[model samples]
Target: MKTPKFLLPVGLACATVLSLLSAFNMPSWANFKDAPKEIIDEVWQVVNREYVDPTFNNQNWQETRRKYLAKDYKSREDAYKSTREMLKGLGDPYTRFMDPKQYESMKVETSGDYQGVGIQLGLDEKTHELTVVSPIEDTPAFTAGVKPKDVLLSIDGRSTKGMDIDQAVNFIRGQAGTSVALKFRREGKPLTLSLVRTRIELKPVKYSLRTEGDRRVGYIRLSQFNAYAAKDMGNAVAKLTREQADGFILDLRSNPGGLLYASADIARLWLSEGTIVSTVDRDGQRESITVSRPAMTSKPLVVLVDGASASASEILGGALQDHHRAVLVGTRTYGKGLVQSVHSLSDGSGVAVTIAHYQTPSGRDINKKGIDPDIKVELTKEMAKNLKADQVATLADPQYARAVDVLGQQIAGMPVEQVVAAAGKPFPAERQPVAAENQTPVATP
Candidate 1:
């Protein structure tokens, strides 16, 4: 049967709309052909009908597809770069294209093993200058004389002023043989330092035994839940136990986070074999991360935390607290419950997206609401002075004293009040804040 002329034109138009809608549903222009025909058609139809952008056209899309499949783009490298540009047009940094080489590098970095100076660096909130938070002891950065409070100006002549902390780390990290020059300002003097990049396998957990007053307490600081953190923690605990540590102080003050698996493993040290943390995706799909019943010791514990404690820190703290395995001291923690999964891009750069938000074993949502300490204490001037003198900025920080005090009380079989009375009040009338006259802000002329 012969089709009507007007109906044929209308039918062709309808078909075009359907095809365009399908593309919208799948947005990956390069991969559209690989998708099911029905899905592709749906994407095209949706885009044609609902997309507010007036530039939508079948010809433009066809040309984009042709360029991707062209034979002249002989190398896989060329094809990937072209595809990357196409994805970048979307302007979402979270969804960029990365080649395999760059993607693999990211995977290595995320695994918490890389070649570089060992330091956690960040921008100064007040100065907006790059600052070294802490240099892991015994690493290239630590041995090469990188210090906290040192403001980085440049790395290899590249300005670090406007770069993010992660970017600075990337700049400093290189193959084991290469040397990176770092320029920094310390105490009004500009200093230049050069060091070779070496393999850095960070051990996140560190511990020591200290006799505070009459009781010997174990002090363990966990920097991040990296690949070896759980094992490191176990060894630290074992070492502390051999030292006859009467009580435990688990310090998780400035830790950011690393592997989720490591976090669960660390938590399992003091927790029963059960849900350490639960995750909820954007779609409301829920899953839980649990651990096996395996650990070195189950001693009376006190975990110290502050505003900088985040992610896996919260997970470990929440688990111990819920299980009555430890008492939390110091200040509120940093709440970062989102779990990121790295996806390799064709351009070598990896994209990490927040696939889920994790919850504590007790069903507490640790995303925005951080863990509150059982005992709140401020850092003492004396402790700060000690830290400054020892070149140990974080350890002698006030949070350390709080942890020791809490654990000391537990050892003596008395409340913190009894220990406070014996040691005398740390803060007296002289330590109280002095009040000044309330003044209004002066306007600049």
Candidate 2:
């Protein structure tokens, strides 16, 4: 999920009012041959006066409105499509108007599953390179040897360069049994791979119990907050408790986040009965999302984050940090405070529009300003090379080490103050951006 944009509060309120007034009050024909003339007049007046660019197309609003209304296109939906075209005339990609159907599709995107290729991708804003974060297990990508850290070059024959993240995703996914070829690079070696598409059932949450030295740690890596995230997390916690796990390390690094409800649901597993997050709409109507006491997870916890952590990730991290439920350690999170609504269209297309802003439990706005770690620890390239070069026991990632250290503080009965004091200083390093490819495989599904 991407960070939402926040327009001026006053501007949003005014726009909401205008949208409601324009969309409501339709032509009610009791037994007439056509829609009443009042409807056309209403649309014409609103379009002529409220449209940002009234000098648009150099065409008369009343004439255009009449042309549309005379064809039995006088419903609220018709007016909305017409208004959308007006906004599209502005040539702004971010500025969009989503109808009810498109909005519902977006909601389904957040909460439902569909058949498609299975790879999680991340785009470098500066380089415009798309990196493969991870492949969904048992899916085509995973089956075809796609791995994390591989840079995606193209999909089918289309280059991903200049393509938006969502646009790229749409190209990669399709109906089951359909094939897409991808060109990618790994460690400077160019390669082409083709795989048959299939339904991807992403288990966003993964957990394991391990014995590190003398301590027992429960590790859970959350990639995204899918609908069943909370259930998976609860099961992990229960398993750990049964196994007498001494501490917990919740890894959320590079997690782009998902389902706002899923994030709150996961947080409820740790937080007591209270507000989890607050959403304030354009009208200042505040909706407080709270957790029940029965859902709280009572264990020593440490949550990990990095630049890729955003949206729902920030929500969970912020909630845990505010309640002191977990000690966050790693780079600052990806700041994204906006909430979006995805509306579907009649023609099967959809639009995602920013609607509101969200705040952490402590009332902090993390949009564009990510959450700072309580104990900041930067992962250096040297550490990455060391782990890749060494035959260390289970993966010795630097961020993981820091998380274990934080969790150890409580498990070893050490004072939180001492643990905080033991945190190492930051070490900044430059890492090369991942590369992209051009040609796709000849054989694709």
Candidate 3:
């Protein structure tokens, strides 16, 4: 793996506005109280000052604030509803309003303890259908044979058609002893599964040393890019390299994404020296992040991605592909180049404002256009649903098998270099049809 640097950029106009963001960026569950009008104003002010799209989706930002503030909000619920209405005008699903429960749920999933059926959900911007981003390992959803990209049809007899991310999560989560029924479609067949809710622990990284032919392959399945992902990944790489793994396969199949900085740290593990990724603001100014440290391993590498892979997954995958540090396998990624900076307001409710958009090292804007893998191995619905966790990175998994074959070729012809080559002609810049419309991680479980 090479050591690459990653960064998220935020445009700050002045110290006054910067301090305003700092004060409002408290923990989602923090105890805070304010009038409904005050809370509404705070959210509007933040979006106006820092939203990545200075044009505010071609609408008047000042008029938007005045319109929302003019309405009389009797309670926080009223304010939240109005806030969501304001965000919708931006035409960006990534920048949305999160009630206290939803924000706290997101916080627990990405950084703290959480409870649920062990599933992360996403919304398709085009269809407005709730889909499975991933099922956290060792959770009820995973055990019930839930797979990524399954189009959610209903939850507890309620249809998910036209449902946004927030509504789906609120329906799925409940008390630990409660059971929830989820109906989704896979390969044109409908299936319903009932799962008992429970406390879910966020275990981000799962690794194994697999024997393929005569080569030892280090298999690392990053379920999500949470707080613990990078550290766990480092440990996995170190231990596997110690065991003399000939190559490594980093699997980011269904990961929806988590923390931004966590993705940065994980990219550095495989990049030695090069500009990993860059962030561009609305004004066309750019900030590029580069690292010159030695890579953890110069061994051959491959990354597996699918339609459910979004956000931080795209960031890490893009960097590796740009540096040619790892060959990408599987299908095109979910496009989510926009970066959202989430902040909890005084009333515990939170706002995720699109602060900037990222570009691949080759200056590819993968917003509506996702990154195409170097080796495309189409994953059929049957194949995605039939493979068990244990079978991944083994012969039974078609994508992993293809990754191994590609890794084997690299191993046979690669040299033993301590540092990866500098960026020359990166992997062919290709874009594919966008799969999921929105892939925001809005819940913990």
Candidate 4:
């Protein structure tokens, strides 16, 4: 899920005030017989005021608005179509238009509750194809054996050739118990699967203390950075710390990021100081966030990431890596670093506009170029299929086992570079010693 910009505390407050004013006041636009046109104009005004790119992808914004407004929209559907066309000119798939139902479904998703096959979808930046980011663990899609990097060919037998992410989402999600047929291109081979949609109340954070030889290791798998992710993560860290856990492995594999504030808040849990992340707005003004309070835990930490880790996942991983706060293991991340702010139109419809681009503390813009792990472990499809939810964090999971080995070295007061196991293969660890200026105190195991 792309982080909902306006849902953050300050933005939410501003939105609340605007909503209240719009509700009570009698607006002249309310009486427009062609109210559909009003929506088109509203979307235009929003993009005019808030889009991250002042050039609007080098298009003539006012002229384009004139062209769209000149058309006589027959219905709300017609206006929606025109609005989508208008947004598409910016050439950003992340900035999308959603109808009322799609908007509501998106809201439910950030709440960590929704009805669907439980798959996170993405548009490939390079291929321009609708791709599966990852499947939510133990959900219908995951159980059905859908894998990451899978290209979605069609939905319900309809071609997905030119369909945008939101449109494909509408086709796949339905009332619980409903079924949708999805054809995917994996390994250049066509494979089809049918999944029954179900109401998914996702638990954003799952943690347990594991006994690895003589060390007590805390395992926390963060599946999403939804609304409740920060609180749940804090609770898990505190509980594990109370249990005298020697170190921690924070698994962010396949965690399609959630709310922006959630990532910032979760970063505060691990980082006592240093920049969490920073954003550059349309005018080039930069905003950087850092936690002033003490962290929840200072024990040695290692992070697990993969190709499906994106957006806020990249944000958190980048911040920690740059600050020398944690050692990362696995493949590079899913590069989706642009920030979006979703807005509800006067009508029930909504629009997600790309409002800002962010950077890590070290000033790395991990947009298309994702952050690389210190230890690169290529988990093949066969290995992934065998590593179910129950097997994760266990010896059966190579990535998790690799992370455990790194954390073990840290607990033993050894440099991270000494650890050399990737999926049981002798791989060179890319861990660089913490920069002299970036060192922070941590508890020794």
Candidate 5:
């Protein structure tokens, strides 16, 4: 059978429609109204053939199709509802059916620019509460003091109990200059914030240089792994290198991740030749993505991660850690190693289905088991508040401070064992230093 023409590249965590039909080319309402059964059958067939989990999460796929198809879907809305119910039976959060509106929103989000209160939201599996994944820096939500892991209680006075991610996003998004009231709970305390929506153009990469005596440490914070991330990061590294930066700190805190290719491209900046990541399909077929580009920098490196770091963030961090190129510091990262590909349907809707599971360069699976920091640093309530208020200096943030310290020691030619001992963290058996000869030479741009 010929594959669908709308198949696109894989995205991590969030749903991002890759290939889409133009609005003008979408099927008319009358067509949808007459072909509800056909639409429902298409959805079922796609999931049955392409879902990553062959067992269907132990749910009978044919039974689900039969149960949903038994009812007569007289309208497009009815077919949409039935399709969603069918997907929900798969028990995978990343695999979901998107209606036309939701599919449009996904496209806008993947484009790296949009109008909304800038924030990425996720649903908490345990509590079933809508949680703030991360606030886009300098946007309305970020400026309004929205922090990661904040549980959303309500939106504009309507409770978010049992609300899905798309529904919550719709409630929070509005026209530029409009306002949305958000009630949320942070650290077990209730709080409210009002934010004005705006045209959010994400500058995914931000950098600043910190001085420690005669040495300058280049600090780069990657907010997400969007399409422009690699280019922006390259510019930052080049500028910092020209400024005589001797060490580097990569902050991946609260980064929920984006495109897989973007993450691999960023990894190539530090690694000259090595496995960046590997993906395993349902049939045990494994494909490795290796770094093809030359190294941008050979400076001593430290990576900062937190509970909110996931997907592509984990991929980059894990590759660096496995290659012994950088030491990870901070709390355990959010583990999300599943790969999803979004397919555009004939009716302008879409379905993001999990296609495979990815592994780090060292062959470690980080799905439910998150990557542990080489040196763990937990944030205190006071420090969290200070960070939100922009009152804390870079050195005052525990994780970041630790990363800088480690990077400084590495620049001074400290041994890995000594660095671990100094940080008061146990040295793992796998923690070995990469020999100088094994380190790839930095390539000139």
Candidate 6:
């Protein structure tokens, strides 16, 4: 919900867990000997006290802890396995354990820089296989021809059949100049690609000006909502406005959302007042409310989103859509409305526990149920292939083209509400009921 202001500095993925750890004067684990129980107790205590669902999803958390606590851990790995098993019972994917290495990697990524082959991975629930969510544009993976929905068969020749998402990522990531061989199945055909890992410095926001039917549209692509997201977007919008751009298209196509405050700050650029998003804690009480400030640039806006758009991305998009500030184009969002607060452990390891569930301005719970686009446009197989091959200009992207078209017809100085009304969509006037206490926040990534 309302993380300490300090936690809001970086991307949600890179929130400062160490700060929280330091405040409690947590003891350090010098070694693994006799550390299993302490680590387990720390996790259990945090979840017991702060988990968003106070009922522990209707299960007896005390008993659950007893079940794990009764086990005799022979080593650190055994303790990790037991802790993971215990968390699995909660059925929340976003809330999980991260070892020291994984936590460090997360910190690097959220800092908007990392040394790795850039690609986002997820677990396929039904098949229990690793899948490629998307490749960071222009990264080693994207340049090597990775695509969304590609089934990862192996990493560096090791079979990935049973590997978790974190394991797969670790295996694929390496120092700059080193190569990681990725074996994947695409279109039912097994294929292998050798990608040389490198330093990935993410310029989260990229912009361009496109002319459609004599109208200049500012096209801003937000790859991730990291620390620089708001400032970068503000600069892009300001420059575009100076260039006399009549409309704006905020592209969040493959964006896996980042920091909470980053999203709120970006929303403030458009919305002058009213709630942007709200977080409800485990006790069904409001934890924090992010409201809009003065408008930045009120140019007619369209937000482009796809299934890969999630978390903070959903927050920004949902807020604009609810306030009639932007017409959402493309498919539904990835829907990750749950909030995770990372906490460091004494062993340099960490846990990102779900502390609250976020609601859009209209009070809609978009956890598993994502926000639908006002106009739907699917990226066809042919279009995707052509676009990937650099055969089509980004202006030819079906979704971008549609957004430009919609914005072209909008009156340049019309109010956002009037623009939505002209498109035959009714702007929501009231917030919906808060989510019920028993509602589970579990979902596959």
Model 3, 1-445: lDDT tens per residue?
Answer: 1111112221100111123443443333133235686676777767776788889989988777668766777888888888887888888777777788886765665553666798777777787677787788789999998977688999999998756676678789888989999999976899999999998778889898988899999999898877788899999999999999999999998888777667777888887766666777777767665656778998899899987788888888988886768888888988888876676677676677787888876678888788887778896767756877788767888988888887887888753121122112233434221221232221111
What would the per-residue lDDT of candidate 2 be over residues 341-434, giving only the tens digit for each residue? 4323333333444555777766777877989887887866666456642322244777777677678777877544446556653321111111
> What digit string (tens of lDDT, one per residue) describes model 1 on residues 1-445?
1111100000000000111122333454454343323222222233233222234322364454444444345455555555545433432222323345544544565566788877666555457688765566678887877765679999999988656554576678889979999999988899999888899877677778877788877878787766578788888888899999898888777675666666666776776555666666555656666655565676678888876677778878887766556777777876666564443322233333334566676667766678776667655546444565344423355666656666766776864344434444332222121121231111111
lDDT of 5: 0.77
Give candidate 4 regions above 4 Å deviation.
1-34, 381-390, 415-445
TM-score of 1: 0.64
Per-prediction TM-score, please? 0.64, 0.68, 0.84, 0.87, 0.88, 0.86
Tens digits of per-residue lDDT, candidate 6, 284-326, equal 8764444435787877899999998888889899988877788
- Which candidate's lDDT is highest? 4
The TM-score measured for candidate 3 stands at 0.84
Q: What RMSD, rounded to one decimal, does every model reach?
A: 15.1, 11.8, 8.2, 6.0, 5.5, 5.5
The full ranking of all candidates by lDDT, starting with the best, is: 4, 5, 6, 3, 2, 1
Residue-wise C-alpha lDDT for candidate 4, range 392-425, written one tens digit per residue: 7798889988888889888987644444342343
Clashing residue pairs found in predicted model 6: 12-258, 12-259
Locate the minimum summed-lDDT window of 10 residues in model 4.
Answer: 8-17
lDDT of 5 by residue, 1-445 (tens): 2223222223432333343233332233344434876567666666776678999999887777667766777788888877877877777767777777887787777778888999888877667789998998889898888889999999999999866677677778879999899999998999999889999887899898889666698989999987689999999999999999998999999999888878888899998877777777787777776765679998888899989999899989998887878888888999888887776677777677787888887677889788998888898777676674453327767777778778889999986566777778766655332233333322212
In order, the Cα lDDT scores of the candidates are 0.59, 0.62, 0.74, 0.78, 0.77, 0.75
Task: Name the weakest run of 10 consecutive residues (lDDT summed) in model 2.
Answer: 9-18
Which candidate ranks first by TM-score, i.e. highest?
5
Q: What is the lDDT of residue 397 in candidate 1?
A: 59
Between the candidate structures 3 and 5, which one is better when assessed by TM-score?
A: 5
Give RMSD (Å) of candidate 1 vs. truth: 15.1
Q: List candidate 3 segments past 4 Å from native.
A: 1-18, 21-33, 157-163, 185-190, 382-390, 415-445
